[model samples]
Target: MTFDHNPRILFLYGSLRDRSYSRLLAEEAARIIAAFGAEVRFFDPHELPIYGSVPDTHPKVQELRELSIWSEGQVWSSPELHGQISAVMKNQIDWIPLSLGAVRPTQGRTLAVMQVSGGSQSFNAVNTLRILGRWMRMFTIPNQSSVAKAYEQFHDDGTMKDSSYHDRVIDVMEELYKFTILLRGQADELCDRYSERKQKGVQESMSDIGRMVNNVNLSQM
Candidate 1:
C-alpha cells in the first residue's frame, strides 16, 4: 500500500536515571527516523503512572493511548538490567492495553527493538522486546541494535558518539521507516482476522436480540 503522508513513529525508552542511555539511544533513533522523512514522537515514561494504578482517563494514560493510536510504527529501547529487560520497560509496556474495546491499539503496527548494556553487549532486552512485540501483534523488523558499554557510547550531551553502534541505530530506524511506509495504508487488511470477524458478528447478533427483547418488554408494558 501507499501512504500520502509522512510515516508516524513513536519511541519509548526504559530508564529513570538522569543519564539514561536507553533514552539517549531512542533520541538518536528519533533523529535518524526524522531524517528519513518520518514524523516521530517520544513518550516520557516518568510522567506515566504505574499500570493498573490509575484509570484510563488519567492524563498520562490518555496521552500514551492517543500516541499509540496515532503512530504507524514504534521503536522500543530498553536497558538490560540483571540479565533481562528492566522493570521500567515492562511497566511502560504494561500500561498499554492489548485491546481497547473493539480497537486494538498496537496491532498491525511495525516495531523496532533496541537495547543498551552497561557492560558487554547483550541481546536479552531486545529479545524480550521482540516477544512482547509479537504478543502485541506487531510486525517487528528483522534488524535490531544492542549497544555495549552504553556509557562509553554516548556523550555527556546525550548524543550518541561516533561508532558502529550509532550506525546500527540508523539502520534500524531506516528499516522501521520503510516498513511503516509499506504497512501504513494496509494495516486494516493486513490485520484482519476471521476469528475477530466471527466474534464481532456474534456480538452484533446478541445486540440485535437484546434490542428485540427490550421492544417486546415495552410492548407488554
Candidate 2:
C-alpha cells in the first residue's frame, strides 16, 4: 500500500550537557532523514524528569508519549558511559511504555540506533539500544552508527564534519526511512497476535454481561 503523508520520525538523545555530542549526532540524523522526505522531531531530555520521579501526567512525560504515538520510525542516539548506554537514554525509553491503553506505541515501528563515544569506538550503547527496541517490539534496522572520538566528529557549529562516521549516519537514516515506509503501512497485520485477540474477546464478553445486568436492575426498578 502507498502512503500520502511523509513518514514521521522521532529522535531521542542521551546527555544533557552544555555541548552534547549525542544530541548533535541525533540532530544530524534528523536532518538527513528530513532531506530524504521524512518528517523529524526531537525530544529534549532537559526538563524531562527521571522515570517514576513524576506521574505519567507530567508535561514532559505526556510529550514523550505523544511523540512516540505520532512517529512511524525513531532514532535513538546515546552516549556510551561506563561501557553502556547512558541513563538519560534509558530513561527516555522507560517513559515510553510498550502499550498506551489500546495503543502499542512502539510495536512494529521502525527504529535505528546510534551512539557517540568519548574514547575509542564501542558498540555497547547501540547494542543495548537494539535489545530495548526488541523489547518494545520495534523493528530495528540492521544498519547502525557508532561514532568514536565524538568530540572530533562534529564541528564547532554542532554539525557533523564530513567523514566516514558521518557517511554511516546518513546510511543508517536512509535504511530507517526505507524500513519505515515498508513496515508502517503493514503494522497492524504484522503485529496481530492471537493472544491479544483472545483478550479482546474476553473483554467484550464481560462488557456484554455488565450491560445485561444493568438492564435487569433497571427492569426491577
Which number leads on TM-score?
2
Q: Per-residue lDDT for 209 in model 2?
A: 59
Model 1 weakest lDDT span, ten residues long: 201-210
Score candidate 2 by TM-score against the native. Answer: 0.89
lDDT (10s digit) by residue, model 2, range 69-109: 99999999999999999999999999999887789889989
Cα RMSD, each candidate: 9.4, 9.6
- Top candidate by lDDT: 2
Q: How accurate is candidate 1 locally (lDDT)?
A: 0.90
| Predicted candidate 1 versus true structure: per-residue lDDT over 45-104, tens digit per residue | 887888898888999888888899888899999999998998888988887888998788
Candidate 2: 10-residue stretch with minimal lDDT: 201-210
Rate residue 59 of model 2 by lDDT.
Answer: 97
